[model samples]
Target: MKRTLISALVAGCVGLASFAAAAGTVVVNGSTTVLPAMQKISETFMAKHKDIQVSLSGGGSGHGIKSLMDKTTDVAMASRDMKPAEVENVKKNGGEAVRFTVAVDAIVPIVHPNNKVKDLSMQQIRDIYAGRITNWKDVGGADARITVVSRDSSSGTFETWEELVMKGERVQQRALLQASNGAVLQTVAKNPNAIGYVGLGYITKDIKGLTISGKAASAETALSREWPLARDLYLFTNGQPKGDTKTLIDYALSPEGQVSVKEVGFVPVPAKK
Candidate 1:
């Protein structure tokens, strides 16, 4: 059979994998970081199902979670784990929220491909974001004011960056706020002096990904726990999945589905027994 392109609209933690999904339309909302993988998976899944439709929206993980609480979606993708308060809220709203680890994601520190500097330590990354290192020259690059790009507060990716990179200091207000992973890539790709953080899937030939603490970003690195900046990609379904939802979730976790995850530039989980 001839191969065809697959698409997915994922809103959550994204891992590298080959795209795959089952028949039927599934509504997903959450992290923009994972959209590439989701979009790819949707394409793969839709190819098989022929009749099912997947609608994807990205307003951040918070938005996805809220949409789940409101019964507006079938699945919610999240970058960060659910807060204690959020879990309670889900229960209160009669949502049977289940967290599924779909893929592994490395937080990619990217710059315009033209930048000369390469690897950075975690401390150096922190220094850059905290404004302690203000110039590209300070980091062994061209003499330019370091322009910082970031996601809005709604982004789960931003939350993770805060916990891992910012080390709790507030991000400076001067940073440019982007709405999604795509936006961040576009910004960094077009601006010579810009630096921004995005998910592993978003890093491409158009942008350059930096090494952090000497760890390189890759599926092998992330899956083996060798990458310090990587996290598990999650799909949250309120309670036990039913009907097509259950089938789709199963397909997503299946070997075929997982392979597509890697194809779409995410880290695939080990095959389950």
Candidate 2:
């Protein structure tokens, strides 16, 4: 009975294995950062192709890659590129992991709207997350202790943050870890002293997006790779997609689908001239 509802958008937190593919169904699983835009795109895709069903879910990027190697999902949405070991694992399964860039994203640091501190230097951000700077006053805000919010390790957003922001240092043990972008957003939005990072698409009025090192996060900066935390969003398949899989990927990269990407606050892949 639950499977009959496959055409409807399902929660990203649901277990991936719970979904069984039918003849015309396409199972998409992966990064929560990419989930919102894909949800919008899938709705448009399904509307035009009434005979097809698209099931979307999120469990972070690693889970999506694992599902692809396990032959459980048709398409894996990721906010970061596949690591070499992940690619090798697919080869062991007699398949090749192929990536299609669907959009560009900038990981933006966010804080509660009332937080007076506006911009943070890269070194200052590193210090705060590393616990070197524990109070908001240390970086020019109130004297209260700062609460650090972070995405769980399995997330691609975490991996990107670790690479571009943390460098060699680790986030301190005291930091609160959330499972999804939406979780991080809500946690920070409710706490005046909390600071967290999320994909640019997740930025909303509930929280204020902070400029990192004097550069604001925006589509122009992300598309040009001028933003320090900018990265490409991807759709990965077990191999060169065929049949319905190819059709879906094609539509996602089409101009029409790119419009949906922009509408969702992500930077669309530049069209080929």
Candidate 3:
């Protein structure tokens, strides 16, 4: 009887060890715009799949792409599609970048709540960032000089702004360069004369979102592509993802994962027909 009991105890211990070893870890690194949603999804995913671990980090979209190319991370989150050059570089390194669109977002221009300017035409916004419109009064606001706050070159937010708002023109040298959408939101929130832009998910009551070309930035408009600044948020994997990587990505695109997107202030991808 004693021998049988000891054998059963030893078998139980070995089974527990095997279960622990089966747990998988997935590393995701990328856009700050996508960071909040990813963090929430990771939390929810891990809660359900207790054996899986998900780690997330933000260093702008460009840095994430580089990490993927260097084979340091399992997934790369991006607010914009990989540029042609970036795709070529990844291919040259013997990796094919596959993109998955997870959500929709709008680059909403924001200002201090005190700023009276409510709406800006497309040309007016272009001129403001290009240094042509130096004062808020030029766009129907206060007489103070416009303190431009902008994202850094490495940011996908900045690239999207460059394409939609700047239109090949450059943001003025006078603009303040911030590293993330959170930084831009904070800077604009605190300074009454400052104007900046951020992902729709980053908008808060602390800063006022300015209407672009008479259209308000919202999930409805963004998902429908009616918002002029609307863009797709993405996750990139080298070739097709398998195992834990595929599991995480699949979860992110699932209905439950899409709920996390809406909870975090971004538009969920529509359900498949």
Candidate 4:
């Protein structure tokens, strides 16, 4: 009888150890634009879910989606939706990409705080990016050569800019291409003649956000769809997120997670009325 009890206790301990080992870590990779909010959400989540670990990294949205297709990441943070080709590629790789819209953001044109240009029409902004308006003076700024700063092609921010501002045209080769939104912000803030576009969250006192058609990029404007460059921020998962991946996503969509969205300077996804 004692032997039977001892054996049962040993099996119970083994089962408990196996359960603990089954708790896996979640890895998130992707868009720099979504990094800030994800970082905050992860922190809050970790505080509550001490058993699970969450890791995050930024490489542009394209890279993030690719990582998901490759099965390297549990989640992909994107500032834009997956492209058609990307959707097919994930399917071919034995995975389906599922997107969850977590927040709303606007791509705001930024310049050095010292820049005098305050407002630009959509056409003028388009002309500047296309390298047609090469001088700040042409756009009502000081007489200095316009230095165009742009996000790298892999960036979702760049994709949104192409769709909204460039239309079918290409950004001129003369433009300086930065890899991430933060890089664009830093470049624009440092160069008085430089102009770049970044997610609205990145706008700081060091850089001045340009008024598009006399409308500033703000949470109210973005949520109301009054900001011309407004777009949805996404979290992509392979297949329909299950296990820890689902838990993390659920936390991000929770009321507390939406609060983190607002605290991070981005607009939260609105609750159903």
The residue-by-residue lDDT of candidate 1 on 98-193, one tens digit each, is: 998888888889999999978888888888888889899988999999998988899999999999888898787889989888778879989999
Instruction: Give per-residue lDDT, candidate 4, residue 249.
Output: 99
Count clashing pairs, candidate 1: 33
Model 4 lDDT on a 0 to 1 scale: 0.85
Error of 2 at 31 (Å): 0.4
Tens-place lDDT per residue, model 4, 152-205, is 989999999999999989999999999877778778878999999988777778
lDDT of 1 at 235: 86
How large an RMSD does model 1 have? Answer: 5.3
lDDT tens per residue, model 3, 1-273 = 122322332342232211111249887887988887787788899999888887667778998888888877889999999989889988999989999999999999999999999999889988999999999887888899999999999899899999998999999999999987777887898999999999887877889999977899999999888899999999999889999989999999999999988887889999889
- Would you estimate the TM-scores of all the predictions? 0.89, 0.94, 0.91, 0.91
Ranking 1 against 4 by TM-score, winner: 4
Q: Candidate 1: minimum summed lDDT over ten consecutive residues — where?
A: 1-10
lDDT score of residue 166 within candidate 4: 93
Provide the lDDT at 133 for model 1: 90
Regions of model 1 farther than 4 Å from truth: 1-24
Off by over 4 Å in 3: 1-23
